[model samples]
Target: MIWNTLQLALREIRRNLLRSFLTILGIVIGVAAVITMVTLGNGATKSISDQVSSLGSNLLMVRPGQRMGPGGSAGAPMFKIADVQAIAAQVSGVKAVAPETRKSASVVVGSRNWSTVATGGTRDYFTAAGWTLSSGRIFTEAEERGGKAVCVIGSTIQRELFGGGDPLGEMMRVADFSCQVIGVLASKGQSAFGSDQDDVVIMPIRTVQRRLTGNQDVRTILVSADDGVSTDTVKARVEKLLRERRKIGENEDDNFNVLDTKQIAQALSSTTRVMTTLLGAVAAVSLLVGGIGIMNIMLVSVTERTREIGIRLAIGALEHEVLLQFLIEAVVLSSLGGLVGVALATGASLGLSSLMNIPYLFNPGINVMSFGISALIGVVFGFFPARRAARLDPIDALRHE
Candidate 1:
C-alpha cells in the first residue's frame, strides 16, 4: 500500500516537473541565504578574535585621551615618558610596559621609497604585543638607551621595499635619519577593522622622539598583565596609580583611559553574532513562503487528481493512504530543494569568503538544521491539503470530474 502511494506521488511530480521545481524554489533560496550568512558571520567573528589575541590575550593599552576604539583617541594631552616608568614601577600585576609613540614617515632605501606608519617603543613592546621576528634580532637594551638608528620592518614593508630579499642589516632612510633594519616581523595580515597590520616600521622610542616626531610626548602605553592576572585588576591598579601620580582631584574624571584588548574582542564578536542571527532570521522568512507554496500546490494537485482519488477510493483504498501519499510528495519536494540549497550555499560561501578575504567555516549543525526545517515545513504545510483530499466524497469527486 505504501509502495503504491509512493509510486503515485513520484508519478505526479514527474508529470509536472516545471511546476514542482517552481514550488520548491523558495525553499532553495531561503536555505541558501541562511547558511551563507551564518557561515560568513562565524568566520568573521573568528578572524576578529584571532587578530585581537595576536595583540596578546592579556594586553592593556593605556592612553592619555579617552579612546573611542582601538588605536583611537579624541584630542587629549600626551603621556610623558615618566608616566611609562611610573606605571611599570607602581603596577604590580604587570608583566611589562612599553611606551608607544608613532608618526607617518617616508622611508627611502636606494631607489625604493615607501611611506608607512613608523612607531617607537622599547624592546618590551615585542613581548607585550606577542610579536615574533621573522628574521634578525630584537633591539638591544643599549640600542634603545642610546637612541641608535636601528629599526624593525613588517612583512608588507619588506615585500614593498626589498621585494622578498633579505632585509637584515640593510640601511633604510627614515625621514631625516638613515636607520638599519635589524629585524623583519612575521606577517600579521589585516586587523579586524580592515587596516593593514603588516605595513609598519618600528624603532626605539627615543629614536622616533628625536627624529620622527621631534617630541617627548608619548601617544600610548602598552601594558601586558602577568599570566593568571585579570586585566580588570591591572586596569584598576593602573588607573588608581595614574590618578594619584597625575594629581587629579577626587571629584574630577580620569584624564587617562585604560583599554583591555580582550574586552574589545568580545564586544565585537558578540555584535557580529547578533547581526548574524538577525540576518539569518530575515532569510528564514523565505522558508515560510516556500511552505505556503507547497500547501498551495498540494491543494491544486488534489483538485487535478480528484478523478484518480475517486477511483482509488472506490477500489477499497483507505483514507489514510491517500493522505500519506500527498504528504510524502510534499516532503520529498522540500527535502530535494534543501539538498540543492546546501550545495549552492557551500559554493557561494566559499567564493564570497575568498573575495572578501574572510575565513570559510563549515558548520554541520546549521546545514542539518536547515535541512530538517525544510522537511518540517513540508509536513506542516502539506498536512492540511492531504486531509482535505482524504475527506473528499468519492461519489461527488468522481461525478464532478
Candidate 2:
C-alpha cells in the first residue's frame, strides 16, 4: 500500500514541477549553508591543533617579565644569561637550555639588502626549539665565546638571497658587521596564524650583544624537559632557582615568568571547540527555515487536491492511504533537496578554503549526520499537513468548488 501511495505521490509532484522546485529551494540553500560553515570551522580547528602539537608536547618557555600576557615575552622583562646557566645546572628534568636575544637588522648579500630579524644564541638553540640544520653546521662553543662573525640562515632567508645556490661559505653583512654563512635551517613552513616561521638568521649570543645590539642581557630562554619528566615540576624548580639567584625577597613577586607551551595549546584547543559548536548552532537555524517551507507547501498541496481526496474517499480509498501518499511526497522532496545540497556544500567549502588559505578536509561523520537530519526534518514538519488531508470530510470536500 505504501509503495502504491509513493507512485501516486510522485506522479502528482511531476504534474506541478515548477511549484515543487520553488518549494524545495529553501531546503537546498539551508542545508548547503550549514554544511559549508561547519566543514570550514572543523578543518581550521584541526589544522591549528596539529601545528601546536608539532612544536613539542613537553616544552617550557621562560620569558623575562614582571607579569605575563598573551604576547609572551613582549610583556615580560629581559631575562639574563645567568638565569639560563642556572636552569641548565640546577633544574632537574631539564634536558637542554638555550638563552636567546633577538634584534632586527638589515642583511646585505653583496649589494642586495633586506631587513630581517636575527637571533643570537648557542648551538643548543636549534635543539631546544626542535629545529634542525639542513646544511653546514651550527656555531661551536669556541665561536660563541670568541664572538666569531659566523651566521646561519633560515630557509626563507636562504631562498630570498641565494635563490637555489648554496648559502654555505657565502658572506652576509648584518648591522655593519660581515659574517660567514655557515648553515641553513630546514623549512618549517608557515604557522597556523599564517606567519612564516623560517624567515630569519641566527648568530652567536656574544656576537649579537657585542657587535649588533651591544647588550649583555638576553631576552628569553627556551627549555626542553627530559623524557618522562613532568613540565610542572621543571617550571617550579626553575622559578625557585631564579628567585634565589636574583636575591628577591620571598614576599615580593619575582621578576620572571615561566610558561609551558603544552598548557597553552590545551587551553586554546578547548576554546576553539566551543567556538565551532556555536557557529554550527547558528547555521542550524537555516535548517528550521527549510522545514517550515516544506510544511507551508504541503498545506497548500492538501487544499488544492481536496476534490481529488473526496473522489478517492467516495470510491473506497482508506484514510491511512491518503496519509501515506502525502507523507511520502514530503520525504521525497526533502531527501532530493538534501542530496543536492550536500554536493553544493562540498564544492563551495573546498573552493573557499583554498582561496582563504585554510585547510579543506571533509569529515564523513558530520556529512552523514547532516543528511539524515535533513530527512528527519521533512517527516516532522510534513506530518501535520498530511494528517489534515487524511482527516478531511468527503461530503464537504465534494461540495466545495
Candidate 3:
C-alpha cells in the first residue's frame, strides 16, 4: 500500500516536472551554501595549524618586551648572549636555545642584488627554529667562534642570487661585508601571517652584530623544549630564571614576554572555528526559507488537486492514503534537492580550496546531517497541505470548478 502511494506521488511530481524543480531550488541553494562555507572554514583552520607547526615543535619565543607587536618592546633592554646560555644551562627539558638578531640588507652577488632579511644566530638556531638545509653545510664550529664572514641562504635568496646555479662556494656581499655562501636552507613556503619564510640569509650572531647592526644585543631567543615535556612548564622555568637574571623586582612587571607557538595555533584555530559556526548559522537561514517555499507550493498543490482528491474519496480511497501520497511527494522533492546540493558543494569546495591555497576537507557527517534536515523539513511543512487534502468533503470537492 505504501509503495503504491509512493508511486502515485512520483507520477504527480513527474507530471509537473518544471514546478517540482522550481519548488526545490531553494533547498538546493541552501544546502550548497552551508556545506561550502563549513568545508572552507575547516580548511582554513587546518592551514593555520600547519603553518604554526612549521615554526617548530614545542617552540617558545622570548622577546625583551612586556607585549608583542611593533614598538611594544620599545625602551626595554635587549638580551645578551649570556641570557641564551643561561637558559640552555639552567632550564631542564630544553632541546635547544638560540639567541638571534635580524637586519634588512641588500645582498649582492656579482652584478645581481636582492633585498632580504639577514638573521644571525648559532648553529642551534637551526635546530630550535626547525630549519634544515637543502644543500651544503651549516656554520663550522671555528666559523661560529671566530665570527667568520660566512652565510647560509634561504631558498628564495638562492633562486634570486644564483639563478639555479650552485650558491655554495660563492661570495655574496651582505651590506658592507662579503660572506661566503656555505648552505642553502630548504624552503618553508610562507608563514601564517603571509610573510615569505624562505626569504632570508643566516649568519653567525657575532657576524651580524659586528657588521650589520654594530651592536652585541640579541633581539630574540627561540627555545625548543624536548619531546614529552610540557612547554608551559618550560616557559615557567625560563620566565623565573629571566626574572632573576634581569633583576626584576617582585612587585614590578617583568620586562620580557614569552610566546608559545602551540598556544598561538590553538587560539587561531578556535577563532576560525567560531567564524565557521557563525557563517554556517547564517547560511542555515536559507533552509528555513526553503522549507517555507515547500509549504507554500504544497498548499497550492492541494488546491489544484481538490477535484482529483474528491474522486479518490468517492472511489473508497482512505483519507490517510491521500495524505501519505502527498507527503511522500514533498519528501522525494526535498531529498532530491539535498543530493544535488551535496554534489555541488563538493565541487565548489575543491575549487575554492585550490584557489585559496588551503586543503579540501570533505566531512561526510555534515553532508548526511544536511540531507536529514532537508527530509525532515519536507515532513513538517508538507503535513498541513496533506491534512487539508485528506479532510476535504468528496461531494463539495467534486462540485467545485
Identify the candidate with maximal TM-score. Answer: 3
Of the two candidates 1 and 3, the one with more favorable lDDT, higher being better, is: 3
- The sequence of per-residue lDDT tens digits that candidate 2 reaches over residues 289-372 is 988999999999889889988988899888988888888888888877788888988999999988866689897776777788
State TM-scores per candidate: 0.94, 0.91, 0.96
Worst 10 residues of 3 by lDDT: 332-341
Q: State the displacement of the C-alpha of residue 191, model 3, in Å, after optimal TM-score superposition.
A: 1.4
Instruction: List model 1 lDDT by residue over 1-401, tens digit each.
Output: 77888898888789899998998898899889889999998988888888888777699988886555554555566799899999898889899999999999899888999999999989998888777899998899999999999999999999999998999999999888899999999888888778998998999999999987889989889999999999999999999998898888999887778989988899989999999999899889977887898899889988988888898889977899989988989988899889888998999999999997889999999999999999999899999999988998999878865
The lDDT values for all models are: 0.89, 0.83, 0.93
Residue-pair clashes per candidate: 0, 4, 0
lDDT of 3 by residue, 1-401 (tens): 99999899999999999999999998898898889999999999999899999998999999998999899799899999999999999999999999999999999998899999999999999999999999999998899989999999999998898997899999999998999999999998888888999999999999999999999999999999999999999999999999999999999998999999998999999999999999999879998798899999999988988999999999998999999988998999888888888998999999999999999999988899888988998999989999999999999989767
Q: Report the poorest 10 consecutive residues by lDDT, candidate 2.
A: 68-77
Once superposed on the true structure, which residue ranges of model 2 sit more than 4 Å away at CA? 54-57, 69-77, 398-401
* Alpha-carbon deviation at 88 in model 1, angstroms: 1.4
Cα RMSD (Å) per model? 2.1, 2.5, 1.6
Candidate 1's displacement at residue 397, Å, is 2.4
